[model samples]
Target: MATIRCCTCGSPKENGKDKKNRIEMRKKTKGKTPRRISLRASLRASVRDLLHMKSKPAFVNVSFKTDSSRHRFIQEEIAKYGKGNITSRIFTYSELCEATKNFALQNLIGEGGFGRVYKGYIHDLHQVVAVKQLDRNGFQGNREFLVEVLMLSLLHHPNLVNLVGYCAEGQQRLLVYEYMANGSLEDHLLDLPPQKTALDWTIRMKIAEGAARGLEYLHETANPPVIYRDFKASNILLDENFQPKLSDFGLAKLGPTGDQTHVLTRVMGTYGYCAPEYAATGHLTVKSDVYSFGVVLLEIITGRRVLDMTRLSEEQNLIRWAQPLFRDKSRFHLMADPKLEGKYPTKALYQALAVAAMFLPICL
Candidate 1:
């Protein structure tokens, strides 16, 4: 058997020292009993904590410019609704341009419906950051920029990406976030490069739990609750350690409050992730986000895209393709990602699938 070793995640600097640090870490944790945290139980704890949590002032140390009309209205909306307060610095357009080397083509890390994201170094902050430059041609994209800035300014959590600063200077609508080294979950989980290693079953389960904690913070811990209208593989960023943090708040909306049951808004979100009720009637509840999470969980499990035109028409929709297998416990193994090569535990796979089924909008 090979020698046992431990490695630090999300920290490239620590990778070289894994062997040396192993004994120290084990010594530190040797006397303590390790507790296993389950997805369902962690959610229950989030609710209980919310019930007992006392009101507190803004905990984030924020400093920013506030002169433009946008500043007057675009400050993080979660804080406005009294969810929590988070703050960030304001970056000049020139600074961002300089950081990204005039938006070099090589530094581009990601691009999506909202805009192109580039990796940049901010000298003032003394850190690398992911800069999202909103697509100027998109009119609705402009509104998305406003919603994201306001949402991040106030909401802070380990599972939620940190907003370092923003560039709402003139026609430039850019958001600066702490650099996530490993890139989005979609990068590692979806397409497989022949040389790249596939994610192990345990890592997939761990990512699912972390993503849930982030959603739990938004829905249960936030004062008014936040609906993450767009929850998908691309939006869930990862660090060097493979930890998941929910990013891209451009589509976020505050959930219902007081006697209201749900917030009614135009149906919006990724094609396969939108809840049925939301798509049919535009009634969005926390359940909408749940459905999206379920889709992601399934993606993580089966290594399949939520919607794929390349697959056969019958198998194009991931949920529809898996529903039959979900009914019978014996067929659950059939739904596991082929890439896993059967390395995962059978019991844990069943538990993870059960969580996914529970969050999906329909019964298994």
Candidate 2:
């Protein structure tokens, strides 16, 4: 009998004898587990979430753009199969309109470069949900829409946002997700209303740790290893208990593997959070995300915006303001968020700062 490896369990046995064992293992570990799929030769550009703008689109006439025929091929495949084939619930445009009260302005909870997000109630599921309505002319297009559907449909983890359903009818494109009560880390850390409670040292660290674990899952557990091209505080959503979940798969890229150095692609991300090397060259690697994660970690420690122009020129950039202090252990206290009111642990502060330094680019 020939020896064969079980794809799901990675156990080896005589091909005919363990066939039943393989089926048993798969049945026992159903939806909660991930399927082990092999990596493709190259990831399609349409699979990436490229931020488009009027003056400066995320991707231009770059070399990485997929061939026109290939782009159309994917579009046709998605159109023919539709959302019903993807295993994610499919919602008609009218059904979503009803769920979100006809998408009234009052239901709108958040808006960004891509589109407006609305809070909705789904009676059938007896659950509250977040509905993302993509702008036809905004940064996200049909490619971005399909990419998100496919990515979220395949990837599942505790720290990643759950895709409940999606709407694709006529010209409208929308995504439905499990409602995040606390909103994003950006809301808790950067600007807060007078009565809004501030995140303490412990809560901030917990959120950071959860966000890091989510990235680790994508980078390590996922067979192809996803690179979160746009890793920032705003993308990290929090539930009722302040647990963090990474959202917005629009800019995510599949990491290079098997001795490959990096994948060359267009530089696409927020200005301040982009890694310096990635910005200089279109070469993207797992470290590109690590660099952005560091910036977010720094923001959590200091309670400062990544790039605030209102501050003095020297202090406007958070990284620039904290670099000198990172060298002196005594001044590490200065890096703590003023809102923290000096209540954070001294030793923990040092350890967090040390982690931030590891992510930042070193002077050569």
Candidate 3:
């Protein structure tokens, strides 16, 4: 028989090795303790799991944070993205639906290649806005929506349309923008009947200059630079004062970051307004905008759509028909819209025509 010694009591044991092994086992058992977790680590893990489960595509409509830390975080993030003062608001889909009456056809202002735009009043802001509901069915719509959000969120210019806020609820994607009272330049230029008050030369010139400055700002002022992919008359909106603001940034792209002079992209623009080089090779440069601007200037000068299928066979395409008339100042009168009727400054018109002519060959 073995007499055991308790390790703690230091009692004698006949089987010393067995007693020692028993003591060691007891010590090992005593050393074992329950694992503990940090509150923050546990919380983070839980949040990650929740986010994984809610994997649907959505936009974060961030509520304006009153907390100093949260506010500072937002400010820092906006600064990192090189954006100016942006008033943050998180509008619920229910609230917006109520405001626009569930995006009824009655609320719709216009429809374009991108999506349908609706007019809505944001009660908090106390202003009306144009809500562009992106079509989720098309890949192009999603691509354009992302591009617009990325570019517009960081951009702020007087001549550029203001992006008030955006919505991303499940498959629903919408962009809120400042509403233009007068609609697009194309609307006034082409859609209005002959009896309506046509755009005067002064207003037209101002529109041209304003549009140019907007494009120039995108090219020269914007960080990393941007090229307005679609620079047609329809994209130019007029305020109550008839001041032009460049809207519809869906096709906008960042300029080349490297030594490359141009960005190579798939051809994406209205048929007749796209630069000839870009249309042919998908190589887009700042000059592409200049080419489009020239086309618009031609339209303004001639009061002709870039492509008018209704016109005579010889004069159906504006650029092709008008390019030859550019050299003959005598033909400048022929190109001028009958509505102007010698109302514009001859020298100013002539100079503008000369500039448009110069761009034509390059664009062609």
TM-score of each: 0.77, 0.80, 0.74
Off by over 4 Å in 2: 1-76, 79-85, 362-364
The candidate that achieves the highest lDDT relative to the unseen native structure: 2
lDDT of 1 by residue, 240-323 (tens): 888899998877776765677887777778889898889999888888898888899989999999999999999999988999
Candidate 2 has a TM-score of 0.80
Which model, 1 or 3, shows the larger TM-score? 1
Model 3 clash pairs are: 3-14
Q: How far off is residue 258 in model 2, in Å?
A: 1.9
- The candidates, ranked best first by TM-score, are 2, 1, 3
> For candidate 2, which ten residues in a row score worst on lDDT?
1-10
Estimate, for each residue in 1-364, the C-alpha lDDT of model 3 and write its tens digit: 0111111112242477876897787678652523211112222222223223223211212333454433234324333322332343435567678768899999999986567889999987898988888775643454465456555655667788988877655556678888999989998887468688889887887788788878877776554457888899999999999889998877776665446677777788898888889999988888888888888988888889999998899898998888677756687788888877778777677766776766667332
In model 2, what is the error at residue 357, expressed in angstroms?
0.3
State the C-alpha lDDT per candidate: 0.74, 0.76, 0.69
Worst 10 residues of 3 by lDDT: 1-10
lDDT of 1: 0.74
Quote the lDDT for 289 in model 3.
85
